[model samples]
Each structure stands twice: as C-alpha cells, then as structure tokens.
Target: MSRLYASLFYQKQVTEIFSDRSLLIYMTVVEVALAKAQASVGVIPQEAAQSIETICTAQIVEQLDMEALVMASEQAGNIAIAFVKQLTAIVKASDEKASRYVHWGATSQDILDTACILQCRDALDIIEAQLGNVHQTVLAQAQTHRNLIMIGRTWLQQALPITFGHKLARWASVCKRDLARIGQMKPRVLSVQLGGAVGSLASLGNHGSAVVSAFSRQLNLTAPVCTWHGERDRIVEMASVLALIVGNLGKMARDWSLMMQTEIGELQEPAGNGRGGSSTMPHKRNPVAAASVLAAASRVPVLMASLYQGMVQEHERSLGGWQAEWLSLPEIFQLCSGALERTLNVLDGMRVSPEMMQRNLECTHGLVMAEAVMMALAPKLGRLNAHHLVEDACKRAIKEQRHLKALIGEIEEVRQQFTATQLDDIFRPASYIGNIQEQIDAVLRQAVGAAD
Candidate 1:
C-alpha cells in the first residue's frame, strides 16, 4: 500500500487485516495450528506441538527481519519458504526437539494458502458488516421516498415519471443480491488448503486426512473434499464476487454523480468540512465519494481478471500464476472494502431534494408525460393513431417552445377524445407512477424478510 493514496482508496480496518505484519501473524497462526493438529492426530509429539505453539508468539514474529525475509523470497519464489525458515529457527531457540517438527508433513503453499484464507475470513467479516450497514441505509431511503415523484431518465433523457423510492428500491435489490452472493461464496472460498508438496499429503503417511480435519477444526475453517493447491477456482470465485460488488457500487455512484450535476441537482453527496471540495473552484462540491467508488470499480475488474488468468497453473502448483494472487487478491479485498465504506458514508449523510426533483420533472415542459397522454387517448383514437398524434404533438411542443399539454390540447382529435380536466390529470407526475408503491413494497418485503 502507498502512503500517498492509501487513505483515499483503502479502509483502515481492512488495510490492517491485509498488512505484512498481519500476514506474518496469520502465517504464524497456521504454523501453530498445524503443529497442534499434527499432535492431535498422533503425527507429532504433543510436547513438541506445545513448544512450537508457545514459542511462535506475535512478539517472536515481530522480531524477525522482514526486509531480509522479503529479499530472500526473491530467490525462494514465495515468502512462505523464507517465513518457514525463520519460524523454524524461532521454535528451535526455545526447544531443539520441537524445532524438528516446525513444519513437518507440510509444504510452503499449505502455510501460505491457509494463512491467506484466515485473512480473507477476517476481511470478509468486515465487508459483510459494512454491506449490512449500506443495505439498511438504502432500505431507509427507499421507504422514506416511496411516494416522492421524479422523472425517470432513459439514455440520459427524461422518459417517464417514477418515485425516487423506486430508484432506491432498485439499488436495494442489487445490494440484497450481493449480500446473498457473499453468503453463498463463503462456504466454498473459506475452506482449508492443506495439500503437502504435491496435491497429496504423502509426507504424512497415514495421518494426512486426519491432520487436515483436525487442522480445519483448529482454525475453525471448512475441510474441503480434496486439496485445492492447483485448483484456483475458489480464490477466483472470491475475486469475481468482489468485482461484482464494486460494479454494483459503481452503478450507484454513477447515478448519484449524474444526479448531483448542477443542471440536475436532485441529489448531493454528504457535505462536511473539506469534504467534496475543489482546490480552485470555491463553489464546487464534487461527488468525491462517488468518484472514489467509481475509480475502485474501474480497477477491481482488471485485478479480478488477473486472478482468473492465474487459474491456469502447471499441474499441482503454479509457477508464476499462484504468486500473482499474492498481491491481486489483497488489493481486491482492500478496494472492495473501501468502496463499501464510501457508499455507506454517502448514504448516511446524503441530501435528497424532492423540490429539485419536482422542478426537473417540469423542465421538459410536460413532454415526459407524453406516454400517459398517449395511453389515455389510445382507448378513443386507437393505439397506432394515438401514438402518431402524440408523437407529432411532442415534436411541435419542442419546436414551438410550448408545453406538451398545451400542444396536445390544441389537437382537434385529442380535444374530441378528452376534456381539459382529464388532460390535466394525465400530465400530473404522480398520476403516471403506476404501481410504484407496490413495487417498492415488494422490494422492501424481500429485504425485511432477509433480515429475519
């Protein structure tokens, strides 16, 4: 992580979870857990396991020369190799007999992969909690604005009337699905990776399977049906899910930033001291949170792709492909966490302008209601004739700089079909938002049921 942009793009808790020191600690945890599991399965002396566990403390891990370990990893191909050496030495210093089994019957990839899985479990917990917060905020916004009328845009142009609640409910539905995806993925992705040297734990003799089960129990992780040393699908699946989450956040950010435009001031990101400000433009309150989220969204897909590419390993373990995930996966988690935090911040303090939404709805001079007008006249003029007549009135309204209601009223055929009061009702934004409350309620029911 860079000191320059880390604060801007990384969440603190997640960053700490993926930090080098934290990684070292997690690796130590795997080493300790492995010893205990081996001892439990009668593969190692319980006294030796106790020695390894007691010696491999956070203090011992912190005392190691990280720079030297990292430099040694340059030739070792991965940090796990160098890390195991230091860990062995630390255990040896306390008890010579115990040091013999520091990493007995295990490979470097086992320690590294299991440690990374532990890290992911912690990181995902934070992400899930933050997502729950964002989802709750979205639900609250949807409920509050369920009846607030606004013009729905299509291809960047006003199309028809809709409630702001309807827009928020759509966002809420995606969040619900994202939450579900995370839940479903955890079981598969959070399993233990315990294959030795090759895919089989050949070094452990008859104790491999038993050791794996005990190790999983020790770490509170799932014992997979088979080793995944070469199978990178679980890791890639996690990266893909993280990318999906950021993509959803990006969509929401794009909409919010567009809505915050000066010409369309229907929404604003949360304002605070020095928040969303421009250095030169004193009048600017940019959508900084949305911009950050969009930036993360843009970057996560490529990182996830690299993980996907890394799936093609040479047999049991990869050469360069497995190492590729050493950085990419952490960055994905970091960026995904940052995006979630930014979204929650925006939702927490965001300002919604029903008045501005109402004003913008009329900016088109009632052209947005043409569909309603057409439908109303369809019963009398026939669907095709009504569509043609309303289409003509819309063009005339734009060309003559007149309200569509006025232009439609002047149409001899339209006047013959509908009275002024009926036409007035057709132009009301609220009148055209059909079943919006029901739609919003349906989404809310799903959300509320999920909470239960």
Candidate 2:
C-alpha cells in the first residue's frame, strides 16, 4: 500500500527496496541479463543463459550464508566477489557446464552499478506518485479556501492580508516545478552501466557494444553513450533532487507547526485517538508527521553532499568514492520516501480554522491594512506625505491601544482624501488580495494538465 507509514510510522516498502535480500536479487538480475545479452550474440551457449535465468529467483539467491559473504566482501573489496562466487556455486549445483557463464564479460562495478540503477528506478516511481498526491492535496486546499482571508506574515510579523488559497497555490506552483525537475532527471539517471574492466569493454572484444545494447534492452533501461564507471553526475543529480523535495516538505512542516501553536491556532494536524497524543499533557496535540518530515529534511542535505563527493572518482574506477555511494544512496532514497509519505498524510487530513484566521488578522489591530490606507491616500497627498501620515497613525494606534481604522478616520489628511465607507473598505482583509482568484485558476489549470 502507498500508506507505508500507517503502522508504527515505519515505511516497509523503502526498507525492502534497499534490503540485503533486494541487493542479491538485483545483482542476480544483472548477471542474468548479462548472460542473456552474451547469448544473443552467440558469445555463450543459450542453454547456460537460460539456466542462469532460472536459478536467479529471490528464493534461490537467499540460500547463501550471509555472514561469510559479508566477511569475504570486506576482504575481497566488493560484495560482487563473494556474491558471484555463491552464484557460481548455485549454478554449478544445477548444471556443471552452465556455471562457467554466470557473470561472463562483466566487471564487479558493472553488476553493482546496474543493480543500483534498477533500485533507483523503483524508488523514483514511488516518489513521483507521492509527489502527484502532494500536488493534488495542495490544489484541493487552494480551491477549497480560495477567498478565505488570513494575515500573511513576513519575518514572523503580520505584514498584509492574503487569501489562504493564495498561500497554498504558491506551494502548489513550487510542487509543480519539482515534478518537472523529477521528469528531467529520469532519463539522465536511468541509463545502463555495462562497461568491462577500465571502461573500454576490452574483455568482450568486438562483441562488447552488441552485448551492452542487448543488456540494456533486457533490463528496460536506456543505453548510456559510454560507460559511466567514473562519471557519477547522474547519481549526484538524483540525490540533489531528493534533497530539494525534502527541503520543500520541511518548509511546509515548519509553517504548519508554527500555525498550530497555541497563540496562532489557525491550523492543526488531524487528530485521532492515539495519532498525535502527548505522554503527560492532555492538551498537547503534537505535530508527529511534521517531526518526521522535518527530521528527514534536516539530514538530507548532508547525504546529498556525500553523493556529490562520490562524483570525484578515480579514473575508470573509484576506491573510496564508489564506496561512499554504497550506503549513502540507499539512505537518501529511504529518508526521502519516508519524508514524502509523512508530508502527504499531513496535508491529506489537516484541519483549518477559518474563524481563528479571522481572529488572528484582528490581533494586530488593523496594522496589517496600513499599506492599503496609505495607497488610498497616495493620490490626494504626495507618496511621501501619505506614507508619513499612515506611519504616524500606526504608531499612535499601537501606543493608544486603538484600531488603525478608527485612528485614520480622525486624521485631517485622511478625512479630506476619503469618506467613511472608503476608509472601511481600505481596512477590509478581502480588499487587498489582488488577482488571487486568477492565480488560483492558473495554478489549478497547470495541476490538472500535469495529472493528465
């Protein structure tokens, strides 16, 4: 289920994708594809290729002793060494003659890199779908509250009045751009890795290019222009995109957390019997989903840096650089997956308090509408005079604990410039939200097109 965080808030699909079992399965898959590629060119017997395919099942791959395999991998410099050994043994048991062609004409880097790409392909599907869900959730919020008035804050202080839908639609627009970035990254990151030793394909001689083409077809991946043994740009780009996704989610969480504060009380994450409960304080409705999303966001940048560091590989092969990716890539995918799911859940069930938003708008005592009043008086007085008059009124209103609207009416300059009804209109929250409906329509139109 896509709801991978419902039970205990742990994502099982992400765990399974990068699991030890999955590693062996994809490695075996790569080896079998290579065998099939070789067989297509008559470099190896077709019977051996067929046998390799039969024994590469998840059940058979799990039979090897994992403890010894891990120790051997530490000594042998790569897991593929111990893994191919075990795979050769398994093939030998079924048919002695077929064992010779298990991982023919391929380097360990080829097997591992292609396997990791396969895993990335799987992770991307999940992320893209979840991104669509987030886009839809934000779109729904915008459409539902398109005209609902709220105070927009700058530097954590009330600055002006804006529709809640306008705020949500801005996030939706950002998410639409994120989806575009993911689309652009897909082709770049999904290319196959099939180069032999030193990336020259010298092991397969003249048949190297043919086998590479066939192998890419077998795995349903794009053929790379050349071997990416030392080129780690695609991997780094993917990590960067995931980091951006988490960062954006974190921003939303931070806003939600702040709005849910007791003083603000304009929003709340969905509440259930045990969903966001406090251990001691009965009144505390904690932001559990935001906590996970923010934590992932906080840590993803460092993980992305590790992938960027991996881009500095040694010629045709890397020692420490490739090793950095072994743990970092999987960790990036897992953290991003969990963060995406949490953000989706948070948006899907969150509650909004329109009344509270209205109340909070009045908390500043019409200071949020200072710009509106200034603009209405700008043509009557010069721009500087209007600004000074409104600015003086604001200070007086704050000092006397009075509304700016009422104080502005008493000013001679403001009274000469505008009538009582005009002054009242200038202070209204809805009067200041310019073109918000048009913007909402435009954002929703793009979102609908994206869904198609």
Candidate 3:
C-alpha cells in the first residue's frame, strides 16, 4: 500500500479490517462456494473440497501478487480479468482437474459484491464498538456534571442557563439514536450476493436456491432475496448511515474545539505529556486531538457523494458504477470508523473547566440572568410585557456597562414588582436549568434499557 493509504484508518493497525480479515473472509467464502458447487454438479470429487480449502488457507497474496494483478486489470481495461488469470495459475499448480471448478459459474460481480459486503460488515462492527465507548464516556460525564450550571447560547449570544450535564446528555442521545439506526440496517446491508452473470443464476441450473443457501451458510452471511446486481439501494443506505454518524460526531468535535479556544477556554482536549507543539511560541498548547477529530469529520460528505453517485448503476451489470463503488465505499467506511474512534478518545480524556465555564457566564456582567428575571416576572406581568422589560434592562446593562442587578434596581417597574430579596432567588443561574436531572436520567434509561 502507498504511504497515504497506509496512514488512513482503514489501512492502519487499530482497525485494518477492510484490508485484512475482511478480504481473507471474502475470498475464502467465494472459493469454498465454488468447491461446494463443483461437488453438487459431480464435476469434482467431494474429497477435492479439502484440497481447495487447503489452497485457500495459503496466503492469497503469496500465491498471487494482488497489487500487480489489480494494476494489470486497470491497464487491460477489464474487471477481475487479472484475478482470473492469477487464480487459474494457482489452481493449475494445485490440481488440474479440480482447478476448472474453482470459479465455476461465477462472474466478476459475484466475488466482488460479496467481498464488499463482508468489508462493510467488518467496518460496521468496529464503528459500533467505538460508538459504544463514546456513549459510555458521555454518560459518565453527564452524571459527573448533572448539576453543574453554565450559560446557554443561542445565535451566538447568551439566552439562558443550562447544565453541562444537559449538553453531554444531548450528545449521548444523538449517538444512541444512530446506534439504533445501524442495528436496524445491518441485516439488510450485509446480505450476500451469489447470482451469476446477468443476475439470473441460469448457469447454476435447478439447484440455484440450494447453492445460494449453502454458500451463505458457509460464509455466515445473509443471502439476498434476489440478485441485486444493479440494485444499489442497500449500498446507498449503508453509506448514508455512515455519513450521518460522521456528521453527528463532527458536531460534537466542532463544539468542543470552539470551546477550547484561548478566549473561550471552557473545555480542553485531553493533554498528554508530549501532546502539542509550540515550535515558535513557547507558551502554546494546541488542541491537536480536537483538530484531528474535526478533520476526520469534515471528510465524510465527499466520500458519501461517491456512494450517492454509485446509486445510479447503469444496467443489469453496471461496470462503471459498480467499479466506482468498489473504490469509494470502503474508503467511506474507513474514514467514518476512524473519526468515530478518535472522537471517543477525545471524550474519554476531555477536561472540563467548571471555573472557566462560570467565568464565561459572568463575562457580560450577569446579563445572561435576564431570562431568569423575565420568567420570574412572567406570571405577574404577562410574558410579552416581561420580555420587553427584560429587553430594555439588557440594553441598558450593555450600554452603561452595569450589572443586570443594578439595572433592575434602577427600573421602577422592576422594584414595584419584586423586592431585593426576591431578586436574589431569580438571579440564581442554577434555578433556570429546569429538569436537567430528569432529562439525563431519561437518556441513561434509554441506553441501559436498550442494552438489556
């Protein structure tokens, strides 16, 4: 593999799934199916199955140079033509009579499509496991800060008070929903394909259904209801799901990265002993982990477009569209899995600055508590009238650079409606975060219930 490809998540040690185990399982399934098919047709002795199995166990790359073969196919303007040549050589060396039955009745699409599905399954497992890790981390954070109060912003301005627990709970809920979506789609998306050329299976004769069943059983995959040679809905669905997962994780990363800014240091990515660089500036601690998650998250849409375009397969066998997907789908899965896993790492070691959060809330000198005053007076003055009153107080607080409490004391309407003692109760930031505990509990309940 090229250095660039090797550096990617799909190609690395952490989850080198698509390139290694997935490919091996796919080829093994295809070769075994061919052997079983030959036995059914009486073309090869049943004992020959062991020989075919043995050959498959030998390293596929050792027997045939896949890199050269793939490149040769591109040079020749053919699909699997090079693979056929290489497999023929391997079989010729093994046993001539049994060799003819190696890829009997199978077309390029059969092997390629099944292999892609296996890759998808492997990627899904890795992504799900990483998401589960993220879910647990978020849950723990939510529990830790269930009562910790902070300002909530809307349209880039403070609107009300909220708990850090509420923020973490919202993230957990999004991931929980996506995890459910993945579970719902896995069975349909990972189903196998065994139809021969033209998707009719006509070459397999009357035992077509039995052959497909046996083939699926051996591969530990679900056989499709019918040949989906040109039906690209499942591929599109799976890729879209992956894109959604990345987008959600991106939202989380974006928020955390922004909060880690020097001016608004309410949070920080986990800092290690040798975490970040300050090549020119001595007092710099860059948010490299947060930046990495952000970069990974940003790449999802373009990868997803490849799958979207592949949805428009040309005909019964779309050579161009299917070939495009063969390259794009695995890359999409790779990027998503990488992003998800890294995002988990970020959340697991994330540091919360409660003092910083409180300081940011006070940056505007208690202007954020205006909403509490509005709600407190709503029952007495009516919501619309109280809103306008609070609006005036907020403008004065900003212009005169005065605290909201001072502005309220200056307003005659505010003094007439409430006493200084009453003002203290309304100004409490923690009071405005209504039902945060309830919501956090609800999310934990859902995640735990689903797990059970």
Candidate 4:
C-alpha cells in the first residue's frame, strides 16, 4: 500500500509487529526457557537453557510459513501453541537435547505474556527515540520562529496575537511532557512476566525468584515483584501512557491541518519530489502527512480501551480478558508506533508560512486587535463604557466592510478615548502579544528540568 493510504486509515500493524521475525525468535526463546528452566530447576539441565537460547537466536523468519502458523494458532486457540509447535520442529531438527527442553512445564499464558512484553518493550524503544527526535525538531522550529507574530485563536476564532515561535514552543512543551511520561513508565512497561501456571510460580519453588531474576537479567528487562497472572495494571498503565502520546500527536496534527487550509494558509508540510497527491486537482496539495498522523492517533484510544477492559481480569487468569490483550496490546503498540513515526515526519518536513501568517493576521479584518484596543481604552473610558464604544465601532466597521481604523476614526467616542497615533499602537499585533516569548521560555525550561 502507498504511504498515504497506510498513514491515513489502512495499516497492517499486526503484520508489522510479527513480521520482524527476529523479535519473534527472541521472544520464543525467552518465554520457552523461562518456563523450562523454572520448572525442573536442577533436573531440567542447565544445558537446556543454553541450547534453547542458542537455537532461539538462530531461528529465522524467512524459513517459516507465517500464514500457516497464524491459521494453526487460530485452530489451537492461541498463537503460543503454534509458535511452540514450529519452534519444537526447528530445534528437534538440529539438537535433540534442546528439542526436549523446549516449552517444558508451561501453560500457554506463560509463553504468551512474556512474548508480548518483549514485543511491547521493543516497540517502546522505537517510540521513545522517535519522540525525542520530534521534541528536538519542534524546539528548533520554536526557536527559529520565535519572533514571527500571528493571531492566537480560541474556539476557532481569534482571541489574541501570538508569535509563531510561541505556538511551536507550546508544541515542543507538550511533546516533552509526553517524553517524560514515557520515561516514568519504562520500568513498569519493560517489566518481565514470568508468572507460571497459577501466577505464584508454585511450580518453580524457591528457584522461581532466582530464575526470574536471571531471565530478566538475560533479557535486560525489569523483573516484576511477583507474578501478575491476574494483575494487569502494568499493561493498563502502558496503554494509558501510549494513548496520552497519541492525544498529543493528534492535537499537533489537527492544528497543523487546520493551519494548512486554503483559507488559513498559515502553515504547510513540505511538498517533496514524487510526493503523491490527486492527479486531477493539480492545485490541490492536501496535508496527507498530517492526516496520517491524525488517523493513526484516532484509533489508539479504542485499542487501549480494550486493554483497560483486560485490567478486570478474573481469578488467576481470565481467558476472556487475557485473550482480548492478545489482540489489543500489540495493536496499541503498533498503532502508537505508527503515529509517532508519521508525526516525526510531519515535524521534520513541516513548512512555516510566516508571510501567510502575517497576511492572515489581517484576515479577521483587525478584529483580533479588539482586545488590545479595549485594554488601551479601558482606563480612559471606564471598562464597561469602553467595551460598549469598541463594540459599536466594530459592528459598524463589519457592516460597512471598512477597516477598524476608518470606523474608529469616525467614532466620536473612540476619538475622544484615544488619538489616531495611540490607536495605531493598539492595533499593532506584534505589540499586542503579551510576554509570549517569556511564556515559551518558561515552558521550555520546565520541560528540560523535568526531562533531566
């Protein structure tokens, strides 16, 4: 599929997650030995872990029948079963000792949960790095455009004047906060899941903890305090965090998409060579990149809600809830990862139309400066009286289709409140942006401190 189609609405995230094959191989080895080594302890033979470990590292995706595996997983009622069946064949073909050790003393949950964690962790690494790059790119734009003044809107209408840099700074600040949230969640998100049959690791006895520590250490994962067979707070927390990131990216994409509208024309994503668009509408260059980010972000919350439901797992395990996770967790990770990747592209290639911004500042027919004029005239005319006078003059200007300057020049009350010279200062959008740069700086410093 084209990049546009994938980013917008059609994406095969499930395929992306398992298609790596290398990650799958690692997951199979880790989950299998984690159960095997914990089960027989001194009797299972340490060589089993070694052999299983070596074979896992050697397993190749190119040699396997993925479609068949997926279909068999459905028949077996789980993916882990299919994975073990295939892996057992591979190991048996090479080493009988390793083949005997494969998937020993483990239920399907043990392998599935650990494998999911490992996959989720890999996705997180990619997301964290991408978020960092996005943050820096937005910060650079914020600094570069710090003085480009434009109108600030609330509720789709102009509220006040603000610099383009200030807006970019806000974007950077939101992204930085997301980065911090992800950092706070890493330890928990990366925690190892070694819960055996009933989650108490009752099958492993005293060596359960040692084996867990070893398993986590070998995989560079954080070992959970106890089995979480029935506790899904960690997964829920991860889903929530990812959704938060999605929300941030969505807001950014939505705003940029709005700014790129023909009527607005204040911003644009770079039009690169071979960039795809409508063939018939030669003049139309849609914000496809931004649209992709927004589309990916929009699906994240629904996927995460399923994970939230999974948090209500019953007893030692809820096949119902846990089964939901098998579909939901990977979907969440893949959706979020796709959104982050698209968002980074948007930030990296976004084009700022400072000239257009200045032009659009006048698009509102100087109404955006109404607040500034009111403030300037408030002390002179009394607050309520000043509001009434400016309100009347603004209405007249709109009706007559004339500039506020011309209408105010003819208004006796406005003339009495302020001179033409003073009115010019009041109408200056740049002069009206109050301490915007300072606010930006403060937000940046706070983000940096929190990140540090």
- Which candidate's lDDT is highest? 1
Tens-digit lDDT track of model 1 for 127-222: 989988999999999999899898899999899999999999999889999899999999888988898999689999988999999999999999
lDDT of 2 by residue, 1-452 (tens): 23444333335687688888898989988998999989999889999999888877778766888998999999999999899999999899998889999888788999999999999999888888888899999999889989899999999988888888998898888889889999988988897898888888888889888888999999999888799999999888888888888898889889988889889999999888887788899878988888888888887888788888778887879888988998788877888888888888878888999999999999989999999888888888978899999999999999999999999999987887789998888889899988888899999998878443
Candidates 2 and 3, the one with greater lDDT: 2
Candidate 3 has a TM-score of 0.93
| Total clashing pairs for each candidate | 0, 0, 0, 0
- The lDDT for every candidate, in the order shown, is 0.91, 0.87, 0.77, 0.76
Off by over 4 Å in 2: 1-10, 450-452
Best by TM-score: 1
Q: In terms of TM-score, how similar is model 2 to the real structure?
A: 0.96
Q: List the candidate 3 regions with Cα displacement exceeding 4 Å.
A: 1-15, 20-25, 37-45, 76-79, 450-452
* Per-residue accuracy of model 4 over 315-419 as CA lDDT, tens digit each: 887868888876677666666777777777777888888889888889768887877877887887888887887888788888988888777777787887778
Q: Which rank order by TM-score, best down to worst?
A: 1, 2, 3, 4
| Candidate 3 lDDT, 316-362, residue by residue in tens | 88857777786667777777777776687778888889998899888
**TM-scores for every predicted model:** 0.98, 0.96, 0.93, 0.89
